[model samples]
Target: MTLASSSKPSANRKPTSYESLMAGVAAGAIEGAITYPTEFVKTRAQFSADAGGKRGVMSILTDTIKTRGISGLYSGSGAMIAGNGLKAGVRFLTYDSIKELLRDSNGKMTPGRTVLAGLAAGVVEATIAVTPSETIKTKLIQDASSLQPQYTNMVNGTIGICRTEGVMGIYRGLWPTIMKQGANSAVRFTSYAWIQGLMINFTQPPSGKLSSTMTFGAGAMAGLITVYTTMPLDNIKTRMQSTGASLKYRNSLDCLTKIIREEGVQRLWGGTTPRLARLMMSGGIVFAVYERLIGVMTSL
Candidate 1:
C-alpha cells in the first residue's frame, strides 16, 4: 500500500493503460449514478432563464419533483450513466499518458506541469466524449416542451439531433466544454496534487501507505475549487447545448451575453450548490476509487 508520488515512479507501481481506463470507468459509473439527482437539479437550474436570483437547491429539487414528477429528478441520467465511464476513462488515461511524458529526471511533475497535463487530458476527453454526451443529456432535459417529450431516451435524443442538425449539432458546445474541462481539470489536479503532497509529507506512514481519507479530502477540496471557478462556463455550455433552435446562441460568448441580457449576470452561477455538492462527492469517490483500484490491479 504505497502512496504513489511524482518523485517515486518506480517506487510506486503504476497501472497499465487498460487497467487505468477500466479503473476510471468503474469509478465514474459508480459516482455518476450516486450523484445523478444532484446533477439533474444543476442542469435544470442552469436552464431556468428567470430564476430571479440564486434559488435554494432544495427548492429547485422540490419544484422539479412537483412539476416533472420524482422521475424528473433523474431526467437525462441515461446519458450520464452511459457516458461517464468513457468520460472518466478518457480523462484518467489521457492524463496519465501525458503526465508520463512530462515527468522530469526524478520522475516527478511540478504542480504547474501537472496542471498542464490535466488540461491536455481534459481537452482530449471533452472533444472525444463529453460534448456529445452533454448535448444529448441537455436536450432531453431542457428541450422537451410538453409531456410527450422531445427525447424519450438517450439513443433517440442522439439520433434526433443527428438527423436535424447533423454531426455538428451533437457537438454544439465543444468550445465551451473544452474550456470548462481544461480549467476544471487544471484546478482540480493542481489542488489535489498540492494537498496530497502535504498529506504524504505529514503522515509518512510506516508502510508508506496514505489512507483513503487523505485521498478523499484532497479530491473534495479540488472539486470545490473547480466548481466555483468554472460555474460560469458550465452554465454557458448547458445553455448553448440545451437551447437548440429556440434561443439559437451563436456560440458560448453569445450564449453568455444573451443570458446576461435576458436573465441577468447572476444567471451564470445558477445551480452552484447542487453542482458543488455533486462534484465534491464525485471527486472524492472518483480519485479514491481510481487510486485504490490502481494499487490493487497493478499488484495483481
Candidate 2:
C-alpha cells in the first residue's frame, strides 16, 4: 500500500471520460436493476443493529414484505442507477488511460506502475464521477429505515435536502465514500496487474501479444480479490447510508472499529455472498467490454 503517488507528472491526452461514462451508464443501469433489491437487503443487514441478530438470513426479504412491500427493496434505486453507471464506466476508462501514459518506453507495462496508475485514476474517477451519486444513493438507501426521516427516495430526498440542507444536502457522507472507493479502486487496479500476468501465463495467448480473453481472465481474478478486501469498507459505507444513521460510528475508521467491537470482525463482511457474485460478474462484463473498446481504438 506504500506505493508512489499517482500525482507524478505524465503526458496529457484527451480523456474520453464521457464515452466510458456512457458505457458504464448502460452497464450501471443493467447492474442497478438486477442488483438493487439485493443491495437494499445488504444495506439493511449492515445497518440494522436494532433489528438484532439479522432476524436471520431471510430477515430482509421478510421485512421488506412486512414493511414497505415489494417496491420497498428498490427505494433508492434511482441514485444507484445514476451513480453506478457513471462510476463503473468512468473508473475503468480513466484507469486504462492512466496506465497507458505510464507505460515503459519499451511499450511494456509494469505491474507496479500499472497499479499506481490505476490508483491515481481511481482517486480522480471516484471524486469527479461517483461521489455525488454515491451521496444520493447512500441517503436514499438509508431512508428506508426512516431514521434520518429527511431522505426517503430520490424525489423526496432531493427536495428534502434542497429545503433544509441547501444544495450541499445532496453530498452527505462523502468523505467515507471517497475513502472506500479510492481503496476499492486501488486494490482492483493493482490486483489486475498481477492477475493479468498470471492469466497470460495460464491462458497463453496466440502469437501476437496477450489475447483479449487472457486480459479479461486477469480482470476476473483481480475482481475476486477486490470484493473480499473492500467488503468491510462497504459494510460501513452501507451503514453510514442506512436509514437510522445517527448510530454514531463517525467516519469509516470509527464505524469499522465499532463494528468489530459489537459484531466481531466477521460482521464486517456482512453480505459478501451476493456481493462477490455481483463483483465477479460485473468486473468480468466491464473488463471484457473495455477490452473490446480498446481493440476498436487500436484498430482505428
Candidate 3:
C-alpha cells in the first residue's frame, strides 16, 4: 500500500489484516508464476562460467531448455510461489499494520513513515521467508559440476540442504538477502510514492481515480529503479546463496571484493537484463493487482 497523494482522492478504507494478507498472496503468486522463466534465466546467469566461457541470457535459457527441457525454466517455481506468497503476505500485512500504527491524528500516512514501514516489512520477509526460498531456488537453477542432479526437486533439495548444512545452511546469505531486500523495498516504495505523486498531478484524473495504464507504467519505472539500484547487492546475495562453501569468498564483503577484483566490477550486474524483464512485469502486476483487489475487497 502507498500513501495517497494530496491531489488523488483517498479511498480512506483500510483493508483488514486478512484481506491484505490474501491479496498479497494472490498478487505475489500470479507475479511469480507469470515471470518465473526470466527469474530462472537470471539465477543461472549470475554464477561463474562453467568451464565454458560466460554465457549470455539466451544461451542459458536455450541450454536449460535443451538439456532439461522447458520444465527447466520452472525448476524452483513451486518453492518460489510458496516463498513469494509468504513474503508478500507478510510484507503488505506488516507494512499496512505499521502504517496504520504510525498514522497521524488526521489518519494519514506520510511518505517517510511508509518508507520505514517498507524497510521493516522487507527485513521481516528476508529473515523469516526469503532466505530459505532463495537458497533452494538458486541451487536448483545453478548448473552442477556433475552430470546427474544433486537434488531431485525442491522438497528433496530443501531436505538435503538441511541434512547437510543444517538451518544455517538454508539461510546462507541471510545478511545479503536482508540488505538487498531492505534496499529494494525502500527504493520501490519511495520511488513509487514519488512517481505516483507526479502522475496524480500530471494527469489530474477526474474523481482522482488513477488510470490503470499510468499505475502500471509507474510500477515499471519503480521496478527498474529498485532493481538497478540494488543490483550489486542482489548479485552478491545470489552468489553467496548459490555457493555451497567459501571456496571463492568467505562472506558478503569477501564476495563483493572478489567479484570486483576477479571478475571486474561490471560482473556485479550479471543477469540484469533477465532480472529486469522479470521484475518489470512483476512490479506492474503486483501493484496493479494489489490496488484493484484491495479496492474490491474494501467495497465488499
Candidate 4:
C-alpha cells in the first residue's frame, strides 16, 4: 500500500507525530488485510518463472484456492499485517518530520525536497522494518506452496528460519528491498502530490482539503505509476528473499541478470498484474483512511 499524502497542516492545528503514526498504523493494517490475497497470488506468480510454469494470475489464484483452500491466500498475512502497520507508521512519522524540516519560510517544500524526504523515509522504513518481515513472509508463503508446508505460522516461521539460516535469513534481501522501497516512495509521493495539486487547481476546496473521492483517485493513480516503475526491483527483492536465494544468486545484481538471461526480460515484471490490482486498491484505501483518521485526531 502507498503512504497517505502529506497534506498541508490544518489551519487550526497540525497533527503530532503520534497522531500520524497511529493513523498510518490503522490505515496500513486495514489495507494489508483487505489486499493480502492479491499479494499471495502475486508472490506465487513471481515464483512461476523458476518453476517453468506459464500460469496467469487467475490461473494461479484459482489453483491456490482449489488446492489449498481460502486460508492459503492468507498464508503469510500475519507477517504482512504487522510489517505494513509498523513500516507505514515509521514512514509517515519520518516523512512528515523530514518534510517539516525542508519546508521554507512560506511553509512549502519544493518537489525535489519532497522527493528527498520520501526517499529518506522509504530507506528508513525498509531498513528498520520491511526487510526482515518481508523475508519471513516470503518464506512462509513459499513454504505453504509446497506439498508439505514447513512453517505453520508467523512465530513458528521466524523461529524456523532463524534456527536454520540464522538471524540474517530474515534480512536476506536488504539491498533490493531498500532500492525498491526508496524508489517506490519517491515516485508515489511525487505523483500523489502532483495529482493532488492538479485536482486542487481544478476544484479549489475552500478548506484546502480534497474530497475523499478525489484523494482516493489520486492515490490509486500514484499506485499505478509506482507498480510499473518499480516492478523489476520488486521482483528482484522477492527472489532474493525467497528460500535458497543465496545459493541460487549471489546478490541483487546477479538475480536481475539471471532472471533476464533465463526467464526473459519480461519476467522481471512477473507479478505485475496481481501487484497492480492490490496496490491500486491499497493506495486508495490507505490514503482515504489515513486522511480521515488524521483529520479526526488533529481536531480532537
Q: What are the lDDT scores of the predictions, listed in order?
A: 0.80, 0.65, 0.80, 0.87
**What TM-score do all the candidates reach, one by one?**
0.91, 0.78, 0.93, 0.96
The TM-score between candidate 1 and the true structure equals: 0.91
Which candidate has the top score in lDDT? Answer: 4
Q: Candidate 1, which segments miss by more than 4 Å at Cα? A: 1-12, 50-56, 67-69, 144-147, 245-247
Model 3 CA lDDT for position 55? 79
Which of 1 and 2 is the better model by TM-score? 1
For model 4, which pairs clash? none
Q: How does model 2 score by TM-score?
A: 0.78
- After best superposition, candidate 1 residue 268: deviation in angstroms? 2.1
Give one digit per residue, the lDDT tens place, for model 1 in 171-224.
888899999888888888787877777777788755455678878887888799
- Residues 1-300, candidate 3: write the lDDT tens digits: 344544455564668999989998898888888899998888777764422356799888888789779887898787888898888888778878887888788776678887887798889989988998988888776634237778777898888888887878889889999999888887887787778778888888875756667777788888999889899998999988875645766899998997888778888888899999877887788888887788788876
Q: Which is superior by lDDT, 1 or 4?
A: 4
For model 3, the superposed segments whose C-alpha errors exceed 4 Å read 49-52, 105-110, 143-146
> Model 2: C-alpha RMSD to truth?
5.6
In model 3, what lDDT does residue 300 have?
69
Best by TM-score: 4
lDDT of 2 by residue, 66-151 (tens): 87789887887887777777777777667656766886886556667766766676677667766666667666666666644565
- Candidate 1 or 2, higher lDDT? 1
- Compared with the true structure, what per-residue lDDT tens digits does model 4 show for residues 241-294? 999898999999999999999989999989999999998998888888888888
